[model samples]
Target: MSASPLKILLCALEPSADALGADLMAALRKRCPEAAFIGCGGALMAAQGLESLFPVDRFSVIGPVAALQALPAALKAADRLADLAEKEKPQTAILIDSWSFSKIAAMRLRKRAPEMRLIKYVAPQVWASRPRRAQKTAELFDGVLCLFGFETGYFEQAGANTRWVGHPGFQAILAHDSDKAAFRARHNIGAGPLLAVLPGSRAAELKRHAAPFRGAIEKLLTDFPDLRVVVSAAPGAENAVRALAAGWPGGAFVVEGEERFEACRAADAALAASGTATAELALLGTPMVVAYKVELLTELWARAVLTTPHVSLVNIAAGREVAPELLQRDCRPERLAAALAPLMRDGPARRSQIEAFPAIARLLAGERSPGDAAAAAVLDWLGTGKTP
Candidate 1:
């Protein structure tokens, strides 16, 4: 009989990738039950039955400064992953996000198993910053799965085998309805125009934003005494955001993990630190002001690399400033107040924002769920012998 079905390696380098990786693995098993999946994932991926070689949390780092500090450990882990891919000789290897390190890991894997197919789950935001990375990605991986519709064109232009697999976040939000009353009751929030504050998920992100976000919280509470401040507490940063908001009049509350989505859905407006949360807020139909803060040196370096005018994915995808963005030094408490006041207060601005939600949702709905589309593309590659 034919040799046992090819072993597929699913490598995840960050926590968020954990969920995406699990979904993909489940789809793969359903599509080809005989195929084996070697797991490189966080807790979520492990729960999906992926054999974990290392914890993904250790590898999660963003921004140039933070990455530099973690470079040694990151390199060691990447090397270990590369060696595993080489020894295993898997038919195909799937590398999820953590673009900075994943790209290097992909290159190393390609060198180790020239015949093995390398699939990149989430293409880097090359269109936003390093457009040249697209060429590098095409050279390193056999195929790429993009989460956004606009990414397909950018990747294809670089001669990469790419597909827009849709953002799983979109599918997730669309599938789940917000339990507004239950959510408010559970959080002990008095319902009167809640303003959700999402500082960001990364530690470095929290350091830069938590303080200013607290200031914004104080300002909102001062101006609108009834405004309930609900913070979407990123995993591991609950206490940090809370500590920063010490001394606030009304006091702030934290919504951890997935509960943050529910809080976002229930909120009338939000002041979000620019990142993935911005997109999440949009999907929840919450009007928001996007802000970002980073180290002075990192910001200076980023200015050289960042090509996009807007950092928030909502604004980037919309091709216009759908939500106001206050970045770096501009992310002051007063300025943040000015930016968010209009979105939260009654008038034409709020109506305009509310009106744009449908179009945004429609744009996000264009692509298939990330897991289904990625699994289908991988299965096709398997059939065509284009991968491995």
Candidate 2:
């Protein structure tokens, strides 16, 4: 008798998915060495043997305005993914991030082939806000592989098979501690307290966050005169971030592209614009203060739709106010400086935050690894009677 092949189709619809998708493919391949991977991804995924139909970056957008602008392209990409699924007819399909687009694509795939098993790598944040979405998971997704443990209950209650698979970013960070001094030396950074500032990854985010962050840096510099600052510029954001902080006193260093993680791991503390970076900073064991500054129009839209008080994942996971969060009107220079100053200076507070890091890691960690667990779940759904 011949052995059956584990045919899997994975869709990566976000920029962050570029890293996470690649990491997942590598992990899945190790466990099920003969499994085949196809569908949408970026450069990293391509390197890991994922056959992509289109560039994931074109579909990786944030904010309502940007989404509206990119909707036509996103719809077309969804159609392309649907076409690939029909032609390929894999045993199971996995969608990673890019919730809006991925959900649409999954719907299309279901319409075409009702028996195909579909799994979502990251669940929507319905627990914090949009509680109704939790009840609607069964409409689109068959299974959900969650990064946070609390997310499982929502999906399970909604009748979707859910798994709390650990986060790949946390796993990557835990594998090795990047040498702080060596990293500093490589960047020509001198002996001084390092403060890493991550404004954001997109153009609109940079516009809202960069100036306010620079303002806070100016205020903090007055108190901590010996402070050294570095801005981890997101990929495709080098020139815009530099322009935003043009007239600063001490100036700042910019680490563009994939080097942002290295800067975060090396910094003493971070004043990051609220998003996934907060979770990344936590895994890197870097104490950070989260802040957000959005356009008036954007704030108005988010205020009406946002479901939770805290925006940082670290606070969401800890189920309390683990770190100070400054958003909207409260994200002023004086306020940010006050919140971050002590986090940079106080040894005990920093240590306490570091001490709580393992618990957060444990909450996000799952069987084998996120990809392997996901792969196993996918294989089980296939009913092939084979181990992953």
Candidate 3:
């Protein structure tokens, strides 16, 4: 008799995880054509044949206050995921990012189905804050697929099986054929110095970043009257981003979906939140000023725990601040504008930042695409109890 198809569960709570989950699914399909996927993810994952149990956006909360407000709903979602696991009985479950949600789900699944293997697609930044989480995560998940080489040691030290699967962001950004002229013509923007503003993808991030980003743009306009602005909005955050950009000094152009990459490539400089966008901008060779703000409580908590010298991945990888970072109190408009001024022109400051991009890119590169590497790791773990 023929064996049944492999059933795999995937859970991704945020936009970035959703993208990672989708890539993993596609790569898995290529290797194991008969694999079946279920559980929760966003649009991209849905395209890869995952019928998500619920809308992932409901759990995309950030900061302590937002997390507290969404706790009840999050608990309910965890239960629903557990119930789904009981019913479907997949052989393996891969929990992507959204550490809080993933932890809850993994614990619930462990209680309900001890035999099923649990894998974590992205390791928490335990090296940055909450070092104990490495051991906790080790106890919960059977294996961890790390996005960076540096992450593997933390997980391995905690006794978790690990594979350095690389980061999909690098491959995705490097693969894009960005057309500067096309993006400008589509938005009716002139050849003047263009600034790409990436506030963030989550609602809370948008809320925290919108005001200061707008203020910074206003200041930039004073220096370069012809400066054009383009705001790249993540899928669900498009409308919010558009409204926020509407009042910018020169009336910013808002691009969603794939056009965001084009905007990033076309811009002379960017004002971005200190997250994945900063890394993406770096990979695209866009000189930028990174800024971030959070709730007072969250900021205090983060300050108490964070061990990393820099928040931006580019800066972290470079071991120095390649792009200027204006954070917390310094995240004001004037500071942001000051940091971006030198970057907007073709000068030593801009060249210095751009010169570091190639090295950062090389640091992130892996033998294969992240999706394929992750899929191979999972499949190998299932087959021979080993991972690459």
On TM-score, the leading prediction is 1
What is residue 136's positional error in candidate 3, in angstroms? 1.1
**Ranking of models by lDDT:** 3, 1, 2
How high is the lDDT of residue 214 in model 2?
80
lDDT (C-alpha, whole model) for all candidates: 0.80, 0.78, 0.87
lDDT per residue for candidate 1 within 1-388, as digits (tens), equals 1265868888887767888899998888887788777847887888778778877776677668988998888787778877887888788889998888887777777787777788998888886798998998888888998888777778888889987788776878777777989988886775677888888877778788866777776787767888787778877777876675556554567778778889899888998888778877778888989899888888888899988887888887787888888998889988898778787778887777777876776566544667878889888886785542
Stretches off by above 4 angstroms in model 3 are 1-26, 33-91, 104-116, 185-190, 201-225, 362-367, 385-388
Give the top-scoring candidate (lDDT): 3
* Candidate 1 local lDDT, residue 275: 77
lDDT of candidate 3 over 1-388, digit per residue (tens): 0155789989998999999999999999999999999899999999888898998787887688999899898889888988888898888899998888889889999998777889999899886778898999999999998887667888899899999888876777788897889888888886889999999987788888888888888888999999988899977888988887786776677889988999999999999998888888888999999999989998988889988888888887777888988998999999999999999999999999889888887666555799999999998888874432
TM-scores, each model vs. reference: 0.82, 0.80, 0.77
Clash pairs for candidate 1? none
C-alpha lDDT of residue 95 in model 3: 95
**RMSD in Å for candidate 2, one decimal?**
4.1
lDDT of 2 by residue, 1-388 (tens): 0265867788886667777788788877877788788888888899999878877676666678988898888888878777877887777788888778777888888887666677788888786678787666667887788888767887888887787877776676667556777888987776677899988877878887866788888898888887888888766778888776566555577786546777887887899988878887887778988998777887888878777777788888877777789998898899998888877876776887888877776665543577776666665656643321
| RMSD each, Å | 3.8, 4.1, 4.4
Query: Lowest-lDDT window of 10 residues in candidate 2?
Result: 379-388
